[model samples]
Target chain A: MKKAKGSVDEFTQAYMEYYSQVFSSILTKVGNAEDARDLCQEVFLIFFDKFEKIENKRAWLYGTLRNVVYRHYAKKDPGVDIDEVFNDVGLTFTNGFRDTRIIISEALEQIECGEDERTMLDLIATHNFTYGNAAGVLGLTRRQVEYKYGQLVKRILEYLNSKGIKDIAELL
Target chain B: MNTSVEQFHQLLGRYKLSRPVSPGDQEYIINSRKQDLKDLLRKKGKYSLILWIVIAIYAGIRKFGIHITMVQSKIIAGMTAVAVVSGSSTGVYQGTKYVIKAISKPPAKVEEKIDEPDSGMTIPDRRTTEEKTKEEKKKSADIKNQDLDATPLSDVPSL
Candidate 1:
């Protein structure tokens, strides 16, 4: 019993460390604070249930959160369109520098990228994850993540250049 | 910005900073985590109860002088297997029925037409081009009439 309690405490400690990061990630995806909170709770509960079997806790939490968010949207709308969600990714950005941000966001949206690539960008840009860390969370090799991110950046830059915005400083 | 890449990264960093989680939210999540842990433990307790009941039943049977024959043991195993198979089949049947019903149900506020030449195979046209043109023409006529009415008498020619 004492050993069980100790293990529970250890799990709780680890859960607390990533709770905010996980919650924010869900919040960004779902675009609702209340739903994000509920999903975050569900993710941790699942983590607790599978704690013994999970080798990589952070990665598992993230993957589970993704599943939870997908399930939530799927349940809310039976025919949820993923492309519609992707097109509205600009709404997920912060309010500061609204014009430039929207432009950059629209440019990113125009780029034909897979969901995995977009998720990798989110992990690196928003969650501040290192390439290796993002790769673990996304269940990808580090090299794959690096290549995808590089391609995403190149596309965004090309998009900006096509828009006659040669000086990146002008937009900033 | 020296480069677009640097500008992009800087903007993302600023966006990340702008979206910091509040202390209240953190606290709420912690409290919810504790509740979840308690609920998980309760579920574990339920499962442990079943295990304990099985153990107790086995112990009681062992203590009794009643020795089970091989035929009886085989019969019991056969019955258990049959029960499991029947239960799983029933579950699958019910699950498939529910999915089919859900898929067949029509969405709200949309009238389903039953006059198709092919009943089950015909895909309904969501919005016909003829209907769209008609609606557009009606809207344009309404706007033109409204504009004519809004024109002042002074602006009209004395004819």
Candidate 2:
């Protein structure tokens, strides 16, 4: 019983630290707060069940969260394209300056990097991870992370330039 | 216009700010974690039951003296295949139907085409073109033989 309490305490600590980041990641995918919350709950519950076995809790949680999002969309529509789903979420934010959100989201989809690079970008850009922290979570070197970030930014800029948006301030 | 990396990073920061999860949402997720596990287990339980039934049937047929007819055997075999292929505890009813359709259908025929050398266009069946070329060569040879036959003694003197 004491052991059980200890485990619960450990889980709660992890939950408090990573819940918002997990929730935001889900919200980005599902574009619905309620569904994102439900999925976030599911992610943590699974984490709780396998708490003792997890090494690198942040990486495991993010990996599991991504799977949950993929399975949720797959169950919802068996053949849904992920880019299309992201575009739909982008379209939902099309009020005034929110159009910049759509442009940025589209540019992200256009980039040539694989899903891991994009996830790394999300960690640094959305979850506010420092280079060292992001590298720790992603199992990448700091130099590698910086290189990926540079390439991602260059791609986004090139895409925006092609669309005649020369200055990032123009989006603002 | 020179766009600095800092400006791009700031733009991303603003996007993140726009999508913040509310405090109420955070509270709801933390509170409902146990209930979410219960729901997941319930869903998994239904599939587990189906899987157990499939395994029991297979074991019974193989070990016991129980006899199943030809059609029943095919159905059972198909169910087992679907369960294994889907790797799901729940019955893949739709997947089974697709598998049955694929198994029952006849193989499709494919037509092969060849390109004409002069016209640079595709024609059906290279064999037919080969036969046509052979016939043309034979006709040309026959015409040349007829011209040589007509030339006769005069052509012999020139030789």
Candidate 3:
């Protein structure tokens, strides 16, 4: 019983450490702060509830977070167009810049390639999420995140180069 | 390859929501022991629900008076527990679907048709267009009329 209690304590500490990162990821995806926080708590709750049943706690966590976010949106606004949320969050991001439209357009165009690459790019550049944390969040190893991030950055650069945008600074 | 580098740079500028949460904020979240308790209770409730559902199903099946061994009873209970959770999840999904469908209705725009009498039959397309135009024209005319009325007739000379 004492050993079980100790293990639970360890799980709780790990959960608290990852809470903010998980909350922010869900918030960005949902574009609503309150709902994101609630869902984040719900994720942790569900995590603890199934703690004994899961083998890879980290992977289960990421999977559960994904499912919770999906289920929340699915319930609140069925068929809520993801593109609209992206546009809204993307616009908020652009508005932070001095030259909102141009820089934003460039940023958006560059990031529009594919899911895994875009996600990797967002984690590294947008959120400043470390490769280690991002990899954990994505159920990947740090080495995998680093490897994929490099590939994604390479692909984005090629796209810009083809468009005659030689330097990233020029886009800015 | 090149596209990814550009994407990385662009994403850097797009980090609007990614601020480092203060230690105080982190502390608050960490200290919310009440929330943790509530969350635990909710899960406990769900598990209780599963247990009750299993009992209910077992009672129903056993109404037939087929005597089962202890091992058989455990297996039936386990299967019933799984069925209860699955049923609840399905209920949640279906309920959410209908709610979303109901809310997605955009408000109906009232448009008057000129080509066809404003009241009766016309293609669904033309009626909406007509109403929009009519509303615009009326709004413009109201603005112009207000402007003319605002200039007192006495200012034009007492004719």
Candidate 4:
């Protein structure tokens, strides 16, 4: 985290620390190693171009990464609307909690939300990002993201209760 | 509310989204980074050279006395100020482009039929050349007709 601070003389340090995580995030979103590699390179080039001006390097990188991935999807299938079609969390659940995950995933999928709402949920929940950082990545103010996340969780819990699945106390 | 949120996050922990970079991708990033940085550094060096050249030219003009001006001191000050600001603020990337154009042979111009796509496939020409030319001609003819119309307050004397 400390290495994410300065870009003046520590570009190499920043790159070494972030390159892998950025690649991984991109790979998960894009689902192709080759495309991910190219997109990751594009993100770095953009970072390089604006190296001097950007602060909160991690947030900015992730933000740019999300746009690049969305653009990649838009390019691949011109007919498909990117936000409408590719707005799922894309997180993989391990076999450990197969049934629970399946139920949860289904409930979340049933809810119709905007792209940023889903992205905010995904980043905060899976990546353990701070609300501020998640908000920054999605180009939302902190309050806006907090509100959206609250609404999202409320909707999910309501949906679950409606389906007669009160709570997964044992899983937690 | 907080407890519920905590429980939600814990549930989310069951799902995962991460992959450590493979050695191959890491190597590519490292190599490409080196090349990119080399280009950036070279551009920086070019900017430095530009600054030095400006300084040298200013010094030469001041010392030679042949480069006299209307107000020598003010002109010198103004020139130096402009030189410094321009040499600093044009950005290294643009400076590199202009410098490269200065040193390298210019490429032959080719008329492009299709504008390049932002990604993936070639861009299709949405409007035909004839359609574009027809619209342009209509615009010019309209302009000419507007100019030919005469209206004036001193109509009797002018007629």
Per-model TM against the reference: 0.34, 0.36, 0.33, 0.34
lDDT of 2 by residue, A1-172 (tens): 1225345445544554466568777877787878987888789878877888898787899789878888899997999776555445444554455666777767766677764576566666655565555554344667777777777787789998887789777665
Q: How much is the lDDT of residue B141 in candidate 3?
A: 100
Which model, 1 or 4, shows the larger DockQ? 4
Instruction: Provide fnat values for all models in the order shown.
Output: 0.09, 0.16, 0.11, 0.15
lDDT of 3 by residue, B83-131 (tens): 9999999999999998998899898899986685666666565557789
Descending-lDDT candidate ranking: 2, 1, 4, 3
Model 2 CA lDDT for position A148: 78
Model 1 score (lDDT): 0.61
Stretches > 4 Å off in candidate 1 = A1-6, A81-172, B1-9, B13-159
Q: For candidate 3, lDDT tens digit of each residue in A1-172?
A: 1125334444444453356456656666776566767888888877766777788665677677778877777787898764444444443534445444444346544555554455455455555666665554344567777777776666556665666668666544
Best by lDDT: 2
Model 3 Cα RMSD, 1 decimal: 37.2
Candidate 4 pairs with clashing backbones: none
lDDT for each candidate structure: 0.61, 0.64, 0.57, 0.61
lDDT of 1 by residue, A52-155 (tens): 77886767887788778878888989797654543343455445565566666667556777655655565565555666655543445677767778777778
Writing each residue's lDDT as its tens digit, candidate 4 over A1-172 gives 1223234235533553465457657866776767877787788767866777788787899889988888888787767665543344433336565656667777766677765565555555544556665543444567777878888888888887887778756666
Cα lDDT for residue A166, candidate 3: 82
**DockQ of each two-chain model:** 0.04, 0.06, 0.04, 0.06
Recovered native contacts, candidate 2: 0.16
